[model samples]
Target: MSIQMEDCLLSYKTALMAVGAAAAYYIIRWFLWQLTVGDYDRKYVFVTGCDSGFGKLLAKRLDSLGFHVFAGCLTEKGVTDLQTGSSGRFKAILLDVTKSEDIAMAVKIVKENIPPGTGLWSLVNNAGISGPLGFPDCFTRKHYEQVLDVNMYGVIDMTNAFLPLLREANGRIINVASVLGRISIRTCIPYTISKHAVEAYSDGLRRSLRSQKVSVHILEPGLFKTELFNLDLIMKNIYKDFDAAPAETQEYYGRKCLKDFTWVVKLMGFASSQFHKVVNSHVHAITAKYPKYRYLVGYDAHCYFWPLMYLPEWISDFCLDIEFVPPAGAQKKKNN
Candidate 1:
């Protein structure tokens, strides 16, 4: 009986030791993580797409909080707006996201601007384009090429060019990927594909930078009230392009297709809101002591869309089809 008791005691002690070791390991890890990423007062942040939307708002917010903000815009008008709106705290640079020379110039400017010791604290890849939305079949090769060039290649080029500055500061890199990256929709195939590629690239970058103490974060935002979906702009483009389509193209799809497209556009406009959920999440990720790997911003992003990310592909497709189908009584009438 004594021998059995000794054996039992030994097993209990071993289990206790294991638990204690695990607890100690976690405590040390948490402490180190906290120490590595804490505080951001006077750090420099470089952000792209500062002309409008989340990028513009985040740049303004960070600048107001005393961070040196380098705002990259594509147009002269955007540069003017950022310069006039943000006082002297934010420096606006004309950066065409698709241009390699522009990205190189931006990196050069950053290297020259910061003093010898100070380094880039955060590099936010927020510049993106929402390409022409329709059935995937409708998109030409040129459309896919254009979208990928702006969304995926542009991000890779910028990151590769500015990696030195990011490493010097042990900075965090934030890429604005969308929920569409996780869950693909019927339309917006090119945009969706580009976002998925961004997620993969960001993940690889995070792994690569782990040893260097540089963190990478991906921001997945839901639909928001941005100029990307401006009704006037969309209508203008649609009419301009519709007129240029082959004469038979309009005869087949007819006015009904146009109406259906318009309805979809209006639905998107209604669903989108002006809330700053995405920008707020961006700020938190950039400024937090312990930044999370992925941030799902906006109500629909976290609530409606992200949950579907775990569903089976077939099931998810069926659900999406049901959600997007026109009403039962609204079917198009056959022409006699």
Candidate 2:
């Protein structure tokens, strides 16, 4: 064989050996982790936004595992619903994270219910909203405020309120960010901004509180089937924004442009609907002896967004080039 061919053959063999070693290491590690479970019965966990999605499922999962669960819900109905699923060691508290008074009330309730000797063991901040679905021009200040209040400020507000309890026990805080946090897309500016803030906040908190022994974590999941990604609901929201726009504004953006934008959501139709990945990840983060700093759920999260986040801006944009909007003339013609 020529020198070039020999070099290529050697490189291929080295790659194969590396892949085999990685596979073996991961397989063994998975089994080893399965044997490790934290002391659940003695731990108290507070989960926010337990009305639905990840919060509801995680609360139920943890409760089943024998952790004392204090679930926070926004409505009486949510509280009642969560209560029905759990009994004894579980108590549902009405909490609106945006309201300091409500958070204070929740703190009082949790303090009253927790086991006498143990402080809080874990807090899962899963409440979030995608906000208005349209271009930056299509939204108002209120639209941005509504999302940031819940998605960004809500987590910060709750963390501050619960830090004392966390410190008392050397606890863990799990913040649910998104793949969008890693890669800011053209769509949903407010949601992206809020998640990015969450990423920054969680990282800062993790380092700042390292000495205090508080392990902060982030959950960055790609598209999943949840109320946040409900198709009919999102379509209705887009229509409302479109109809509310001024006549001149509508003419400028055009109907075809709106349809083109709406169709982009279908890209997530293939996204994993099985939310168990989130539950499992959260469970490990809460129970594992050494949990990861960031638990990335879903293929798109690790395979696409994770690597894209490390790439140069030009390269990242190149990957997203296929999704780029049509040229001006083409869009105008389509509108006509």
Candidate 3:
């Protein structure tokens, strides 16, 4: 056989070996990922935003799995509902993440309630609000601050308040971000900004807490049937903000642009009704002996938003532009 042909055969064999090794590595990882902590009753989890959505669902789930759960709710009804038929292990405290008093009160309640010896096993920062969904300039700094207070700063405050407990248990922090953190959209500027901040904060916290034996994981879920995606409520808020805009700003944008807010409806049409994906991701992040540092949940997150995040900046901008509804004045500015 010719020397060149032998070299080619050798290269083929090397590629096959590499493929086999890669396959084996992933298979082992998949198996190990399924391993979970056995002491459910000893593990305590604190989950915020239990008033509704993923937070509420996860609280119930962990309770069923025998973990002592501290569910931070925003309303009396939220507190009453969870405590009504739930196990004694499930305690719901009225907690609005935006308020310093609420957070401090919650910290006291958690400290008072935690079982003897075990510290908090997980802290899930899930409370968030969908900010005004209109043009960026249509809202003020206060508008942005409202959302950030819950989504970004709230996470920071919760983590800081509970770090001592987490360090004691060598526990983990599971923050709920969004795919929007990786890719920004024009209409949801405040929400996008907050999630992006969360991504950065989670990364930094994960690194900083390594010595403390505190693992930080982030969940970047795509759109889902959560309160944050309530369409009618969202539209109402958007139009409210639009109406409040200065007269000149309104004239420039034109009422016609409000019609384009249909883009939000279309976008939300893709929201998955499978709440379990997010809830399960939270459970895994809490219970799995070797949980992933980042959990990207939902079909849209895995198949579309995550992939789009890696594309060239121009390409991503183009894709996002296709979804953005421009203001009436945008054309005039472009023409000039």
Candidate 4:
């Protein structure tokens, strides 16, 4: 009878231990969630490229969550839309990312608008350009330079201009990079190169700011439905410039290249989203107490692309090719 009683006592103790462990896990999980979501009250954030896409949606989300949002757009129409749609929480400012003068004006506005001691809490470097799409060999020096000016140098100038404010507030810098930054694909060399540069810049900045309490985060989103994939615009531009090609260039690729290219471009448009996933990742990175250094946003980003980042370049290329077919009726060319 005593042995049976002792066995019961052991079972009771095991049950109590299991309950304690489960409770501890719950508490830890709650703490982590809180840490990641952060406090949304009274914080201020600045976002660029508010004209459309992720920037517009992110600005709205942040403003709705009670953040003071300073949204920058390149055009008057964008400014009007943001001002009209949002409550008094958002202030739309005109900013052409490539223009230093516009950048200066934006900085001045931020200094004047944000109350003294409030500082500029976060700078979302969401402004970027996806330059002309074609084979890497097809791109000219001018095209590469133009893309770098807007995508790479523009980011650098903005960050430098706003560094003082960010330092004062001990806030975060969220750069909207791309999965292309981590993995290069065919026919997107200019954009891929620029994004790769951005990744390096963000990493260097993160390490440099470690001692200063400033956090740097990168938002690496896969494909999303946006004006970037406007089929009509792409075809119009390509056709308009087709005659400008050298005689040799025309002979090499032939007319079928353009048709196939358009098909693939249209396919990408259908595959991506009208509603971008980058906005959620951007908000979390900006507001979270301990924001992760890098966030891979989009369904395919985490599921497919990111894992391939670890593979050899040839393997990655093979994997990407299988997933994305070349434009219809365009055969793979033989090496010279």
Judging by lDDT against the true structure, name the best candidate: 3
Candidate closer to the true structure by lDDT (higher is better), 1 or 2: 2
lDDT at 222 for candidate 4?
Answer: 87
Task: Determine the backbone clash count of candidate 3.
Answer: 0
**TM-scores of all models?**
0.81, 0.87, 0.96, 0.84
Residue 86, candidate 4: how far off, in angstroms?
Answer: 2.3
lDDT winner between 2 and 4, please give it: 2
For model 1, the run of ten residues with the poorest summed lDDT: 327-336
lDDT at residue 195 of model 2 (Cα atoms): 96
Backbone clashes for every candidate come to 0, 0, 0, 1
Off by over 4 Å in 3: 323-325, 333-336
Candidate 1 lDDT over 35-93, as tens digits, reads 43434455889999888988888888888887888999989998888889675657899
lDDT (10s digit) by residue, model 2, range 158-217? 999999999988999999999898889877889999999999999999999999998999
lDDT against the true structure, each candidate: 0.81, 0.87, 0.90, 0.81
- RMSD (Cα, Å) for all candidates, in order, is 5.5, 4.0, 1.5, 5.4
Q: What local lDDT score does residue 66 receive in model 4, on the 0 to 100 scale?
A: 85
Number of clashes found in candidate 1? 0
At residue 299, candidate 2 shows an lDDT of 86
